[model samples]
Target: MNRHVTTGFLPGSALAGADLALPGVVPLERRRLQCYLALLFSDMAALFSGFAAAGWLYLGPDGLAQGSHLAQLLLPIFLTVALYNGTYSLHSLEHALSGAIRAQIALGLAASAVLFIAFYTKSSASFSRVLFSGGIILSSLMLAILRAQMRSFVRWRCGGRIIHEIVICDGGVPIVLPGARVIDAAAHAITPALDDPVSLHRIGVLLRGVDRVTISCHPSRQRAWATILKGANIDGEVVDDAVARLGAQGARIVSGHGLLRVSVGPLGLRARALKRAFDLIFASCALIALAPLLLAVALAIRIEDRGPVLFVQRRVGRGNRFFDMIKFRSMTQSLSDPHGHRSTLQGDPRVTRVGNWIRRTSIDELPQLVNVLKGEMSIVGPRPHALGSQAGNKLFWEVDERYLIRHALKPGLTGLAQVRGLRGTTLHEDDLVQRLGADLEYLDGWSIWRDLAIIAATARVLVHPRAY
Candidate 1:
């Protein structure tokens, strides 16, 4: 039986992509940001007020001291931690209950820290336990109240609509979500093209200015546009009816047709910030530590052929943006082909003597740490590919949709595929598929530990025969 489906995505994912929106409203992102900031201040005030009230009730009129301390130390800690945890990100706090829970978690963590600090300072006697307990309860309650009242005002300000959702569906049926707007685009026509400049340009234009969700019923279309959507941190959804058909690829399924909206980018808010922070710190340290080695390599390349020591080329990256990737010049400067044809064979004649040693030892790649520092690349992710890079005559993206999915993340200095010996030529279809699979796996299951593991594996791969 030939079955037709809206998208090959999970049924859960289809409805999960639905969002509420109003016509003529400010771009959705800006609205959300404003709401987040408003609520952040409200939360801070609510916490402070709660503490002050508790102090007055339990510790006489002088309870403002503890409230002052909490405002100074604990409040900042809670807000900072919450920012990374994504509790308040992506408008997840629109729901009063969700907002309340997130507030409680942040406050609870901060309150616990205060308890420990009091014990450590041997000042538990100075801190009023009754007021402290009361403050926690009161703060949580007030924030929940503030969120509920604010949601109404926010919705009113966002166009006075109770249900503001945008949907893309294949059926002749009504928009599944109540009071949602649907944009009709046939599933087949929405197939995403990788290198087709016209299509890429059109998609970007069409999806721009849409602060709310830009949805589609084609999974490949969603995947191809994934980079743009992720890069902008805007919303894009895959709508499908077949529960059995949707392979999450790397996306997590959080609900059954009612899942929370998830970022197409694999890493969550906090992890991403930490990863970028780590990249900056690590890249800075490496550049400082390897200054001598980098200089020596540059000198060697110059002394050998009197050519440019660095080889920079256009490479596709996160959100499909192109950047100049820098590497040590490893091929003979005269024979260097930006549009490469010769494979890195066991003994390629095009490789200069100095180039061969640098390429083999992975010293040629040291310059990319600068890209990491510049925010063009990451320390770990799918390695970026040259625009027309191919296996035989077929490009990597030409092979399958999965290859394009790798761009959902920023390209990396080292990747899971390279560490797994999938570097060099893409001999056949499986080569691209497996390599894409590894990249997807890394994105889906990423953690600090996994990143560390990839880094360790990268070190081993540098000396491996496959690296050449």
Candidate 2:
């Protein structure tokens, strides 16, 4: 199956006499190692040159080498910090700003450390204050400007491929990776046979210059591929659709069996603490600020039909458990659909006059602040759905098996999907599809900053046209 779907500057080789001819991919590890060394040397030169230049300008020709001592003292510290901060790492090669910011941080930390040492050691008087200040300013500016141009430098040095990565398809889902070479295992006789020396040799040759290899294959073949990858001594990944379907965070072999970690909580302890604190604080503040409006809406709903002011309906929440979600009563008491089997439609006869206005402005959902305060819901997450909710004729879970994965986190009053106007009714399967996609994306990456942004975006859609 060895076809070069993505040429990536490597010319595909023609088969010769039953032998697999893999395209020549220059080993990338050496190139990346060389790039790292180049950055280190360039940084050293920048620091030394900046100091020497500053010394000349500030202290005349007599002090051309005056700041050389400081440069020498700071070089190791800066390089060590830069390595840890990823200034000379692969991510730095991709984005110039990432590397520049890291470089600046490294330089700042190094300078601070040197000055702190000098101060405590009573050696501050030895170095001229003006020379030290001028050196730091010049070196920092040079580093930032130099790093800004390193993207092109790395591109030139590494040629077209920054990482020699390849994706080998072995009878599984086909995937496209931007800069990776694609190979077909069947076309190349690349079988996962441990006993077949010829096939093992073929695999080795194909992976010779590669840094990382990803195989997309059926579950039956995954074990074989995993065995081969482990012996190959390269970074490897086996694509399993089950991992995504099960929301598995990672996998590990324990007690002579593999375990897929699907039960892990979305947020870590620290993240949970931060999110809970944020939910409580925001919900509390919002409740107080909107009290007058909440009271007015309640009064309106109560007076409209002389019915109960609040509607409590059973809906799915975090951990796939049932919770009574509260909202302003929006339908005639006798006509209210508690199980949500029937989605409300525009001009639905059951909706009262007050229900129309409150639902339109999302005033009806304000009562969920109590849910947030009770820790049953988050300020932002996938919105809770009633058990009987349907997308078209199919129940939501029946329409898509991944629907329940949304319950891994607490349901929210506002969510990534809702803010994007994917709220209101799930009229079609496609509607749920769009919302589920957004919900899964939110689950993949949760951050307080993103939550804040979603909340801010929610304000714009409070009175969306889709509201019934």
Candidate 3:
């Protein structure tokens, strides 16, 4: 499942230092997804096997009914617990024992929850005591063995294959490492020409083939370096501490490379799945429930303004990717600034008669449920900004160095900042800062229930003064 490569760099090559770093990619999603799905299937198989074994060992055919009851009630909960604990993350799978423990805990917790509910509801007699107890014990032992074997497979295949890379500045000091391997049997690097923006295609081709690319930049060439980083559609690690300047922490040390990537927040595998599921369920239901309301809003906008009903604009999202966010047109199309360099005032002349009401009631934002379904935005997250969004005289990113941190998660239809009264137009530096603070707060402490709470709280402030 991994690439086999012949080492390219020579032993005498000057590849060392903290200043030499690799540009990153989103990582091997196809591989990761395969691994994740395999683990999930493995768990299911083990659960079933254990249950089947226990049923036969306990009370014959009647015990089979007991196993079914427990499995039907507990599987979803167990999966959810595993998701919350990052048990299925590609990053976490390196240590298989931890994953197994989390899995075991998930099963135990689900079993316990069911046990409590069954007892409290006066339904304990419905479950076979022998089957329940035996199933749990057998499942735990089998899962632990499976996990250990999986880890052994990974260790046997990859443990010797990862390389300890050293990226050093040309003519700078070189350090020595004890267990560092100069060559990797499992992975390869592709360093393309970085002379100009014209070389972007060559870089992109190389990036598609490799996990990492070492980028070396002098302190004086920050602008050129940033330009290169911006133009390339890859995760970048700066040799300089610029990422540290931008509020990213070292996630982990990989293969003895001390360099840490600059990231706004931890990218989660489970969070992506959970959020997508939540958004699909929530958006689909809300769309169905509010069909008439959506239709009415569209008809009103079209009739009142004699213009297109929907307003669409490009907004920056996670990892600086841009997507068109849709809304009911709430302003005079001819006069409205789509790039939004200037903040909207409460009584702006650009606001149309229908626009005012829709904007105030947040009916204009209802169309973004499609964006949520499209996977461009979440039901709850930091609201995205237009390309030229400004706070006072400065660009939004210029207002706060941490402004880009908001892009770490998907932009939302409604966010913590909005419900907390930091919505409307950003008229001052403090406005964006406060909203940023709220967004950061949400990011730092995110959960499925937290998102639900935000969604619920959002209904209470749907018609706030700051909304316009």
For model 3, how does the per-residue alpha-carbon lDDT over 7-122 read when each residue is reduced to its tens digit? 21111221221122234322354455666777887887778777777987887887777676676677788788888877786455656667887899888887898889888999
Those runs of model 2 whose alpha carbons end farther than 4 Å from true positions after fitting are: 1-249
Error of 1 at 379 (Å): 0.5
The deviation in Å at residue 337 for candidate 1 is 1.9
Task: Provide the RMSD of all predictions against the true structure, rounded to 1 decimal.
Answer: 8.6, 18.4, 10.5
How many steric clashes between backbone atoms does each model show?
9, 5, 6
What is the TM-score ranking, best to worst? Answer: 1, 3, 2
Candidate 2 lDDT over residue span 1-468, tens digit each: 111112221112211112454567877666776777777777888899888878889989866768787788889999889878888877777666887888889999999999999999999998888998899999988887776666677888788767787879999877766687899988877787543323544576677677667777778876566545544535566676466643444675423334343333456434666899999999999999999999888888777789899998766566444567999999999999876778899899999999998889998899999999998899999998865677887777666656655766889989999888897788789999999999989988689999999999998999999978
Q: List the residue pairs that clash in candidate 1.
A: 9-246, 10-246, 12-257, 19-165, 20-164, 20-165, 21-164, 21-165, 28-211
- Superposed by TM-score, candidate 3 places the C-alpha of residue 248 at a distance from the truth, in angstroms, of 5.6
Per-model C-alpha lDDT, please?
0.66, 0.76, 0.65
Cα-based lDDT at residue 301, candidate 2: 77
